[model samples]
Target: MSHDIDFAQSAIRTIKSERDAIDKLIPRIDGTFTQACQIMLNCKGRVVVVGMGKSGHIGNKIAATLASTGTPAFFVHPGEASHGDMGMITADDVVLALSNSGNTAELVMLIPLLKRLGTPLISMTGNENSALAQAADVNLDTYVEKEACPLDLAPTSSTTVSLVLGDALAIALLEAKGFTPEDFAFSHPGGSLGRKLLLKVTDIMHTGQQLPIVSLSTPLKEALIVISQKGLGMTAIADSQSQLLGVFTDGDLRRVLDQELNLHTTPISQVMTTQCKTVNADMLAAEALNIMEDHKITNLVVVNQQNKIEGVIHLHDIIKAGVV
Candidate 1:
C-alpha cells in the first residue's frame, strides 16, 4: 500500500508540472508562430531541422512529422554540419534550429555559413536574446517555466514545449498548403496509413476470370455452380449487354430454399437482389470497406460509370491488403 501511494503521488506531481508548463505555453502562440509557419510554407526546398542532445531527438521527430504532412524536411546533426554536412543547406531551403539555451556551440558555429548560403533560419529557443535567436530570421519562443525533473536539470518541460511548437508549425503549414490525406499517404506509402489512402479497389478486387458472374437468364443451379466454382459465396447477375442487373448470394439461396422454389427451373434473376451495393473501379479500398461495413455485407461488385460489372471486392481482399 505504501509503494502504491508513492507511485501515485509521483505520477500526479509529474502531470501537474507538465500541465503547468503547457498552460504557460498557450499564451506564447502568437505572431511569432505564424511567421515561422509562413517561412516553412514559402520554402522552395526542404526544411532542415538541427539540434543537439535532447533537442536533437525532438528535432528528428519534428522533421519526420513535417515530411509526412506535406512539408519536405530532414534532420541534420549540428556537429556533423560543421564538419561537412553544411553543404546540405541551400539558398532555397529553410533551417529550423532547436536549442533550449540558444547557445549550443556547434549550432552557433554554422550560423555564418547558413547566412552565407542565404538560407532562411527559424530559431526555436528558450532564450529570446541568445545568439541563435538574434541571428534567426524568425524566433519562436518555447520557454518553459521549469523542467519537470525534481533537480530541474533533465530536459522535460523544455523538450515538450519545443516538440509541441514544432508540431504547431508543421500543422500550420499543412493547412496553408491544403494538404489532404491522399497527399500524406504518398509520403508514407510503406506504412498502414499509405495502404489505407493509396490502395484502390482495382488493386485488391478480383477481376477477369476470378470474378464470379453469370447471365441473368442463367438457371439458379447454373448460377449456384458458378458461385461454387468461383468460391466467392456470391455471383453477379448481368444482362445481355454485360450490365449488372442483380446479385445472388448464399443468403438468397437459403431464402429461396425456404420458399420451396425449384432451383433447377428457376432463373437466377428471379431470386437475385436487385438493389445490391456496388463500388466503382477507381474508388479507394478504404471507401469500399466503409460501404461493406455500413451495409453489413461482405461482398461488393466493382462497376464502371455505365454500371457494368468490372470486378468484385470482398472483406477478405481488404484484410489481405491491410486496409482494415
Candidate 2:
C-alpha cells in the first residue's frame, strides 16, 4: 500500500547481485569441471540428479536440459531416495548433487548409499568444504558472495549460478558427443523443430491428380484453367514423358495480360519460366521454405534425378505442416 515504494530499484539490485554471482563462476570452470564431465561421459547409466528445496527445483531443470542435449539424465528427490528411490540409481550411473549450503540433511544422508554403490559423485555447492562437497569425487564450487535476497536468506543468486553451471556442463557434453540439430529434433518429435528437420517435400507435396501440369504445346488459356483447377497458382510445363520444361504462374498471366497477348492461341512454353526453382523429394521442408523465401516464390516444382515432374510444393503446404 506504499505508493512511493522503490520496487524497481529493489529488482535492479537483485538482478545485479545474480549477475555478479554468475560472473564469479567463470574462474571455477577448472579441471574439476572437466573431471565431472568425463565421469558422466563414461557413465553407462543415467546421470541421477539429487537435491532438496530450492536446489531441487534447479536440479529438475538441469536434468531436463541434460536429457534434451544428448546426455542421459533424470532427477530424483533426495528425501525420496532415502526411502526407496535409491533403487533407481545404479553403480554404472553418476550422481549430481546440488546444495547451496553443501550440508542439506536429505542429500547428505544419501552420500553413504551412493558411495556404497560405487557411483561417481559430482557436487555443486556454495561451500567447497561442506559435507556433500567433501564426499564428492569431483566438486564444482558454486559459491556466491551473497544472496540477491536483502535478508540473505532466500535462495536467489545461488540458484542462478547452479542453473548456469548445469547448462555449461550439458552444452560441453553435447559438443563432445557431436549432437546435431536433427538429433535434438528426434528427442523433441512433437515440436516444431521435429517438423522442420524431419518433414520432407515428398511428405506434403501435391502429386497425382492434384498436380497442376500443362504440356509445352498447351494453350496459355488452357494452362490457366489447369492452374485454377489445381489451386496451386501455377502449372508445370512438362513433355509427354513428364519431364519438366518450364512453369507458368499467376505472375506470368498478369504479364501476358499487359501485352494483350492472345491467351487462347499462345503456347504455355512461350511464356513459362524456364529457370524455375525445383526441389527434390528428399529435401527437408525447412530447406524448401528457405528457397521459397529467397526466391520470393510461393510454389516449387518437385522433380526426380531425371528432371521429371513428381509433384508441386506450395508455401501453404509447408505452413500447414508447421515447418515454418
Candidate 3:
C-alpha cells in the first residue's frame, strides 16, 4: 500500500475504535453514576481528584470542569500525595480516584489514608474487580472494548471514555445543585460568558443629561432633532412629572410619511407609540437584548419603579457590551 493510503486507514481505524469504546460507556452510566453524583453533590469542602500518569492528565481537566460548573474541585497527583500532597485532602472532601487497571500503585496506596481521614472515596476504573474498585465507596466502571492503539499498550480510547465520564458526573452535579448562568458567571467572572450574564442595562444605558427626551407637547420636528442629537434612532416623550408618555421612533416616521403628515406642524404625541416596550435598569443586558429581539425593536427605555424613564438602551449598546 502507498504511504498516504496506509496512514488514512490507520487513522480511520483509530477513530472507529474510540467510537466503539464511547458507545459501550453509554450503558455503564446507571445507578453507580447517580451514586457518584450524590457524593459529590453532598460534598461541602471539595472534590479531591487523584490519579497516576495518563489518568492524572485527565483528572486535572475534570477538576477544572467541576470547579467552574459549581462543584468546587482540585487535582492531587497520586505520586505527590504519597510525599506531602495528601494533606490537601480533607475529611469533608470527596476523593475521585482514576485508574484504568483499578490497581495503580500510587493511588491504591492512599486508600488506607483516605479511609483514616473518613473521606468518601469514588473510583473510576477499567477493571471492576481490581483492588481500587473494591475499596471505593462507589466505583465508576470506565471499561472499553479495546484501546485505539493497535499494540494495545497506549491509553488511547481509554482516556477518551474516562474524560467524557468525568464531564457527565460534573454536569449532573451542576444540574442537581440548581446552578444558574448567573451562578456560573460568578465562578468565571473574567470570561465572556460572565460579562454577558452579569452586565445590567444600567451599566450600558445612557442616563441623565445623555438621555434624549421630549415633552408630549413637543412638535414632531423638534423631536426629530432630539433623536438626531441622541443618535439613538428614537426619542421618548414624557409628561410634566417625567413619566413616560410615548416613544417616536424612525419607524414611526415612516408610517407618518405614508399619511403625508407635515413634521413641522404635527405633534409627536399624535404619532408616537404609547405601548413601547421598556426594561428595568437592573435587568441583564442579555435579557434586554432578548426583549428587543422579541419586540422587533432596536431601542428600549430603562425605567424605574415609578415608570419614569431612567435611561435608554439601544441594540448597539448591548452589542458593544458583547452581550449579543
lDDT of all predictions: 0.92, 0.94, 0.92
lDDT of candidate 3 over 87-164, digit per residue (tens): 899999999999999999998899999999999999999999999999999999998867999899999999999999
| Candidate 1 local lDDT, 272-292, one digit each (tens) | 999999999889999999999
Candidate 2 per-residue lDDT over residues 151-264, each given as its tens digit = 999999999999999999999999999999999998898899999999999999999999998888899989989988999999999989999999998998899999999988
**Deviation in Å, model 2, residue 268 alpha carbon:** 3.0
Model 2 TM-score, 2 decimals: 0.88
Best model number under TM-score:
1
Off by more than 4 A, model 1: 1-5, 190-194, 239-241
Candidate 2 error regions (>4 Å): 1-4, 188-195, 322-324
Instruction: Give the TM-score of each candidate.
Output: 0.89, 0.88, 0.83
- Which scores greater on lDDT, model 1 or model 3? 3
Candidate 2 has its poorest 10 consecutive residues by lDDT at 1-10
- Tell me how far the alpha carbon of residue 83 in candidate 2 is from the true structure, in angstroms, after superposition: 4.1
Clashes of 1: 0
